[model samples]
Target: MPNNPPIIDVIIPANNEEQSIGHVVREIPGIVRSIVVVNNNSTDTTAEVARQAGAEVVDEPIKGYGRACLRGIAYLLNKETPPGILVFLDGDYSDYPGELEKVVAPIIHQNVDLVIGSRELGIKEPGAMTFPQVFGNWLSTRLMFVFYGVKYSDLGPFRAIKWEKLQILNMVDQNFGWTIEMQIKAAKHGLQYREIPVNYKKRIGTSKVSGTVKGTFMAGYKIILTIFKYL
Candidate 1:
């Protein structure tokens, strides 16, 4: 570890993730300074549960995943002490929050600009991912490799980025295109990045992006659209 520890913050975009948000918040490592859970117009007690679980809550009336993440970013922007490394994870409990150290290790040690936790390269529990989700990752990553000259296996949600480098990307995707937009922009900007294996399991409730037909279609379409939007 560096002599002066890095200040870290987490952002979780949640929509009706009442059953899983508490566990996700609790499982995050003690190194984190703050956990910001952006409630994306959830009808349940998602906001209350997150606040009770030790996360500072931000209400975003919009339902888009990227919108909720942006809300969290906006909250962090006003913080007195800015973070050194910023992490993004899901509120659905599919990702092992305890393994955030693994996600951010390269940034803390090797001076990497961005790190993505790849479920495809990790120990995924049975039934953790549906067929469509699997295929979409494969296609998207391949397209990225072809176009950007960078090899990436998965577009997993668990990711970390240096705070300074993140601002240069100017992320604007407001929905399913968020993750890919970051990856593509990082490559274009010549930021060093890596994908490490991360443990993944079946989530407590249905996944908003992969559980429904419409969600899957839109997410896939948006991811592909995002890959080419920069070109």
Candidate 2:
């Protein structure tokens, strides 16, 4: 294996994403060594679509945001040699998979440990992000600055990390706080991290977390508590 061409792995946690999952999978850079799609108990044909798109599909029967991610990460962990870079993106197609190179390049070519895709810096289509979600991201990111001393914008699902270093995070969130949990742990471990702009657009379907009031509240509470828990 050439040292410059790191083995790249992409994990997509999908739930009923038949409409756009296929496109998302296809758009992922071919330079990626492997693509893992965690089908989280979708009633639709997400698994079939992803498989048809040449992505390895795994089942996460339990329905939790983090549940699917944990399952996917476990699959990666079991691999003989861990990938040099791990990229996590939503299967809903809201994030531009083509921009993945920009997100992972910092960690792959440089010495960064984590790279966050910041929607705040990128273009967000109209109605792509709900008002509450925008506010929530702003508020939560501000809290992180005040409490954790780390500055960040949107906790957009599109992100990347060093595979070996990520395992030490020991993330335990089985719900919406998975991103924040990883962020908190990264801060605690003092990992080198950076954020870059990534384009965003409206998803083909409604968001499971932000589409419903109850789900949004639960997500906000979980994210806040996750940060507080570490602090």
Candidate 3:
């Protein structure tokens, strides 16, 4: 470990996740100094419940995964004391929030700059991932390798990165391509990256992306477009 422990922050982008955001906020490890849950135009009680569960809630009236994430990032940028390491995860309670310790270990102890929590490399509960999600990850990562020359398993949203390196990524995607855009930018900037196994289970509610036909199609299309856009 470093002479002083790293200050950690977590960002969760949620929309109408009133049923699950609280658990995601509460289960995160104590090493985290802040949990910023971005309510992405939620139609329900997500912000209210996230605040009740000890998280700092911010509102992003614009509805997009990347928009919510960027909102949280902007909030952190204005923090009097910024984080040493920043983690991004979903608010659907699909991932085991307690596993954040394992997610950031490489950054904490091994000087790694980025770590992706790969469900493919980890235990994923049955039905946790839809067919399109699995296919999209495979295709997107394959394209990344073919084009960007970086080999990665999945475009996982559950990832940890050094705060400084994250700033260098200059993430700009505002919708479905957010995760892929981050990974691509990280590779372009030559950040040291790793993939660690993480447990995944059924989320508390329907997935906005993989749960709907339009969502799945749009997500897949955007991911492919994002890969080529940066190429």
Candidate 4:
């Protein structure tokens, strides 16, 4: 551990989340050194709203969840003093941004390489997650445990990781497989990881991936394919 407190930065990948991005950005904990919001080719005012909320906004014209996250990483890496820890969170308001401190606690104090915020273990409001979302998480996690021998509860979007370890993962998923890809690679690399409970609520708007049948199917297919692709 460094003599000084480790710097922590947050990355939020947003697409057409103008209505909720500001709240997400503003609710993030004060411990974070910086907040970078990647506007993923949104036709709305997501970028402006995030900037107005005192977050650094970067544009990712190509719309993919992982692509937006990668852009945020690139922005951070270009900095002279990149953060020691990087947190990934959705721009949607479902996640409790204030619990970021709890989410990163293990990495900050216990030398943990990764920390996943497990909504499955948390207090969730009614209708916070759809039936398909719940089922997908269950099946995907079970498959990962069977294949990779790592137990994961939910591939929740809110997560923290050591920046150095994260770069080593060479993350490349451009869409739905981003979170699972990270979890799978962490296990394969033998990184120390933990899941901590984090409360969830209904998002400010409909979920892009789960609100529609087509989106849900495509996301599920991509996640399952990615799981097998790595095997």
Candidate 5:
């Protein structure tokens, strides 16, 4: 491990998560150098709440998860001194923000390039993940193993990566394929990666991607399509 702690910055992509964005921001560990919440075309006061809770909020008028994440990355890249590590977290309270240290531990101590928080190996509250969400993760990961020869337990959004390694991925997906796109590119680029368990709970609001039939189908379709696109 380095004598000094690596500079860590967090990025949270939020839609209409006004009810949980504040909590997510406030609960993040103090080790983080900055917390950026991307307001992804939300009608609610997500930006206001996140700012009130000490997060720097950026607006992404386009309604895409990857778009919001890209906006956050752009904000960090403009900084005079960029962080050493970048953590991608959900604005929903479903994830335990306090466990951020655990998620980033591999990168800090083990010199791993990327770390994914695997909810599959973690303790989850009942009904935390819907059936479609579970099935989609299973199928998508299985397909990735077959096609890309990479084994991933869960494509959980709570993840961390070295800033330099993240820049090498050249992420371009503007929608549901954001997380998988990163993972796939990481595998292709030969980045050292690991997965650690992270507890999960019921989210404060309905998931925009998994709460409706249309949303679930679209997400599943996009994820599968993305896995094949890289092949």
Candidate 6:
């Protein structure tokens, strides 16, 4: 491989984010070689808007977060030449696409395998996060430290990981537990990881996972179960 890496493939998992998809797509740094937006069975014009804003759209007719992410990764895996860094971001506009450098810089410039965007470590727009998300992050991170000797805060979707390293992690969480699954597996696999505070704002619409009582409970349950499954 050349000393200067060629490109970075960005995978955005989105569902019904038509209102914000266009802006998010356009905001991704121009240095990104390919932007893949996985429209996970959206009921709106998310795919169309993303395409209009210059993103390669991939259809993932799945409901879970991990399912969509896996589809995106699979696309890159089958490509002629896989990208050096794979960035994962949500389409809900909660994450700042303009800050992509911060999430991927550690991996590209410093040889880190993973970089996570920590929302709790920075300022959050009003209503950007709910009480359950805050508590869940704290409780789950505590559990990771207690059981697996790993530590992370704010399982935010904005993150980046080296392509080959991510493939080796063998991640398998299919739903709300996806973030923690990768984090715990990275710890177990001993990948060089780091976290940086990132700015987050309230999404264009209500969050499917955190806006409802049932969703919140199920997410918490799944996260706990995912951790225990590894232990």
How far is each candidate from the true structure, as Cα RMSD in Å?
0.6, 1.3, 0.8, 1.2, 0.8, 1.6
Tens digits of per-residue lDDT for model 2, 106-188: 88667799999999999999989988899989998999989888989978889999888888898788999999888878988
Q: What C-alpha lDDT do the candidate models reach, one value each?
A: 0.95, 0.91, 0.94, 0.95, 0.95, 0.89
Model 5, 12: alpha-carbon shift in Å? 0.3
lDDT tens digits, residues 106-222, model 6?
A: 887788998989998978998789888899999998999999886688788999999889989987777888989999999999999999999999998878899889999999999
Q: What global local distance difference test value does model 3 have?
A: 0.94
In candidate 5, what are the lDDT values of residues 14-121, reduced to their tens digit?
Answer: 999999999999999999999999999999999999999999999999999999999999999999999999999999999999999999999988999999999999
lDDT of 1 by residue, 1-231 (tens): 689879999999999999999999999999999999999999999999999999999999989988888889989999999999999999999999999998999999999999999999999999999999999999999999999988999999999999999999998888999999999999999999999999899999998889899999999999999888888
How many clashes (backbone N, Cα, C below 3 Å) per candidate? 0, 0, 0, 0, 0, 0
lDDT of 3 at 231: 77
TM-score of each predicted structure versus truth: 0.99, 0.97, 0.98, 0.98, 0.99, 0.96
Pairs that collide in candidate 4 are none
TM-score, predicted candidate 2 vs. hidden true structure: 0.97
Better of 1 and 4 by TM-score: 1
List residue ranges in candidate 1 displaced over 4 A: none
In candidate 4, which residue ranges exceed 4 Å CA deviation? 1-3
Model 5 residue runs over 4 Å out of place are none
Backbone clashes in model 5, listed as residue pairs = none
The predicted structure with the larger lDDT, 3 or 5, is 5
lDDT at 119, model 1: 97
